[model samples]
Target: MNRVVTHELIHAFDHCRAHVDWFNNMKHLACSEIRAANLSGDCSFGNELSRFNFGLKQHHQQCVRDRALRSILAVRKVSREEAKLAVDQVFESCFNDHEPFGRIPHNQNEARFAYRDFQNRDRYNANL
Candidate 1:
């Protein structure tokens, strides 16, 4: 779906802009994966239920964290402890940092192609 594509696109965009060594930088990789999983609707209740059943109604934050952790561990090939440390180190910062939805740019030239921004711009231009 569009969400998944946009999520990976953000990773691509970040790699392009930062020239990050994704293969080696476990922290950076984990951070981006967490952001993508959380922001890209991968952790939505409906999405989760579609993939696996959750008997109890857990908090959304827990669901998001679980989803993010799974994604982070999938790559970087790091031990669980290392991945957990990295995820914990960056979780607060990356999880809160979202584009379009949370438009407080970290810098002057934040990426403008996020889904929310595109939609907002489209709607605004439509009336003009």
Candidate 2:
């Protein structure tokens, strides 16, 4: 039996790359909470991005790849009823235990409401 890996369904927000962002060729669309909530371990989209090429035509391709790497480092799992505890834990470690992002919120429910609201607004408008 062969096991095929399906990457955790996620919404990624890649930073703006020079020409790609300008032309809107590359983008980070937010991942789906419904799909991402069920994922285990480090979630990923699973495509192998090729290493950067050099010379005038490809000089900065590596930089573009690097941006993607930095962006992926902050991902956290979502919860069904609230923002997952795992998120704060992961973000905290990434920020070296910074107070705000690292600190656990007083209410997980509020976080879910806020995150959902933002996501819904984005989805609602995106439909139009």
Candidate 3:
């Protein structure tokens, strides 16, 4: 439930902050999915282990790409090849765009901390 909310919130955040052509642009959708997967803890170590996808080098990235690919497939009428291509095209940039979180939250505790920091961002900025 939390993961789902986090993933969708990422899409909503992108929608509000950027000119995302969700219906007309596969790249835009791909970018959001990559960001969601990377930043929402969808590729966290525990999640990957639960899916029997741990231990490999760069597993987080591979998981993000795979999740983004699955998400694109689920929501779009694109071919696997096309979806994969789109994900691959935007993976590097989107995966690195941490934005509001500032960094990837790899677990629940980290996510909670990030949420706290996010909530206090205005206070931090006001102090600055």
**9-40 per-residue lDDT for model 2 (tens digits):** 12221122211231222122121221222121
* Candidate 3 per-residue C-alpha lDDT over 1-128 given as tens digits, one digit per residue, 9 for 90 to 100: 88889889999999999879999999999999999999888888888778887977888888889999999999999899999999989888898899779778887687788888888878856556
Candidate 1 TM-score, C-alpha based:
0.68
Candidate 1 regions off by >4 Å? Answer: 52-58, 100-128
Query: Candidate 1, residue 44: CA error in Å?
Result: 1.1
User: What shift in Å separates residue 65 of candidate 3 from its native position after superposition?
Assistant: 0.4
- Estimate the lDDT of model 3: 0.89
Local accuracy of candidate 1 as per-residue lDDT tens digits, 2-111: 67796788787667766767877877887777777766666665666797845466545566567667777776576788877877888888787774445432222433
Q: Quote the lDDT for 7 in model 2.
A: 17
Give the TM-score (vs. native) of candidate 3.
Answer: 0.86
Each prediction's Cα lDDT score?
0.67, 0.27, 0.89
Model 3 — which ten-residue stretch has the worst lDDT?
119-128
Over 4 Å off, model 2: 1-57, 76-128
Model 2 / residue 12 / CA error / Å: 10
